[model samples]
Target: MKPKLLTLSLVSAITPITLLAEDVTTLPTITVEGERLPEPGISREKPEDMVGTPADAGDFLRDIPGVSGTRMGGHGIDPIIRGQSQTQLNILLDGAYVHGGCPNRMDPPTAYSPVETYDSVTVIKGSQTVIYGGGGSGGTVLFERKTPRLTEDKFIRGQVGGGYTTNSGTKELFGDVTAGSTQGFARGIIEYRDADNYEDGSGNETRSAHTSQTGNLILGYTPNDKTRLELGLEANRTEDVLYSGAGMDSPQADNDTIRLKYENQWGTKADVYYSDVEHVMDNYSLRSLTAPMKMRVPSKSKTQGGRISHNLLMDNEMEWTMGFDYQHNNRDANRFAGPPNMPTPTMLQSIMWPDVDLTQIGMFGEMQMPVRDIHILKMGLRYDRVTSEANRAGQAAMGGVTPNRLYQQYYGKNADVVDENNIGGFI
Candidate 1:
């Protein structure tokens, strides 16, 4: 009986194996195609598609490879890329340059950039081209807006979004709308953000509270399928910005920008822009006074720039571009002192930035040729004439010493006027 039971068990197992071997299936072959790789040392992103909500351009940049930021407070992060920062990195907003008003860099250029409004952000990690501007040894950042396309069926489009962060009590609201026909279009964008002091893992609160608002409008006219003209106006205001790493808090930081652009299918492009900034910082506005006298600093900066370029495509598939650009930046800052309980500062303590001006005019040419299916040969040349001046360098300060005299005493060089000629290229 035991031998018969064993034989039956073995037959059952063998029967199941035979049935499985007889049953067979086939699957169709599949092929997947991924996106093409981007050019070397260049990265681009769409703000709306980013993983998380970023407070500003600097905050968004920190998420990129080889990029980091200096956190001052709840907002206004200063971006650092590959161990270089500040003037080494050139930042452009819709092809316009916006210089910050804070001398200590509490409000770097990225601070004025509202991430939600821009369509695209491009980062060039190294000196790869000579078209944007000069002295970008570290890299260049471009925040750009694309032309809105509308048809007879879809003449209007818009989007709105809001978010909240529980840990930091941060609230954000942003929206944009576009209305157009086949001939013209008008677009508007608005954003608001508010944040309170945040706590760390230990539940200790940090000094980082701020409020910001931004608005922008763009009008575009498409004369034909190949030509377009656009005008843009933008404003940004921030208040009661607290900083833990600094001695003062920014009570007001405002920016206004205007730009006009022209483009055609012939690869011709031209743009002119102007940006103005006003920043005010005080020791008593958002925090308790630590010194005997209250201190405040008010600063202003203005930047005007323009560029024109034309691209030529050869029969051999090579592209050549030639352009000229000019920029002028002016800045002034003053410090004031008063009693701790004073409602407003009264005494002029010092002339921190005494009407400084920097101007640059440059001409550049570049050519790109395909070296095969996978490689490209690129080269460029640029020349710039820069002029710098301290208009009020002889003005008296708190200690009755002139800024020019201090410069002479410290560096043994005159600070009144300086000029430089720079020539650069890349391969």
Candidate 2:
């Protein structure tokens, strides 16, 4: 057995800690640019900042420069960009497409979107991007609502908002609640708006008044950091919508929508959505019988669409995307017109739209690369096949309807119930 003992010496070294403090008289100046003019025709705005700012969605779009709205009454104004509207412009709500049931431009796509509920509004000036959808000859408008990401262990959040306007005697109330944890989340929203007939500056009241109510529920599942799936449902109701241009007022409109979305870490995403709208308009609902004639129109629209896209990255400076999208919209409208204060006459019943159906399928590819330190290059290509068809024959006041006569008399000689196939591409 051997035992060893060692001696230890302790040495101390002086170390100086320099506490440097210099008297500073001036601070570095930082110049910040807050607002700049948008692109020639494109514009973007945060809906929260513009709350209680406009009368309706149409008015909201008009706030952007170069955008104008055709104001026919107190609400549901049609937005026109540069000089085009209707089919010329493409509009989307939360990436879903919706077409109005009105044929006389009384209810455009914008009519269904309660701008207050959206998070942001983006206006694409022209047919520059074929990524969203086709038929953007005039422009594209996107209203998006971003879902909240739950990153905390536990959280409960809510928002409540309300506003009023005097000109149209309008009132609005909105509320939202979201409670969730890190793995999953659930959110719900409710909104209501009502307005009375608005008078002009001259105190002449117009037949423009409306009431709307909407509710939404969304459920999100995030199993991991790289995968997510969401399901959403929404319902909307609008009553007593008076139109100055049309001969009737919308007495009732009920709309419902369902959406499902999935995304993965591989940069692949898919979205599917479906919407149905039922609308009824009649003169007697909000107006007295005029011109010794009473009219009523009932319409319906159904829409469904989906898209699948994948993003690819090559090296660090180049990127590419390819996707395919399909959308189908069908509209049916009929009118009943008769003498006032008398039994409804058979002669006045007529087919207005006669089941018009529009289908569009498109494929698109795009690439982006940095050309230089000061500039970037981007290019996209899209091909779309569109089909528009409708029943041509209708019941006339006098009698005997013919498809050839209806076609040649209104549009052209070869105008039948089915239109020619249309195929086009854009870059």
Which candidate tops lDDT? 1
RMSD of each: 7.3, 11.6
Q: Taking the tens digit of each residue's C-alpha lDDT, what string does model 2 give over 342-369?
A: 6543344566676777888888887778
Worst 10 residues of 2 by lDDT: 6-15
The 10 consecutive residues of candidate 1 with the worst lDDT sum are 397-406
Tell me the tens digit of each residue's lDDT in model 1 across 27-58.
79989999999998899999988876676899
Per-candidate local distance difference test: 0.92, 0.78
Native-structure RMSD, model 2: 11.6
Name model 1 segments beyond 4 Å from true.
1-32
Off by over 4 Å in 2: 1-41, 224-226, 342-348, 391-398, 402-404, 414-427
Positional deviation of 401 in candidate 2, in angstroms? 2.5
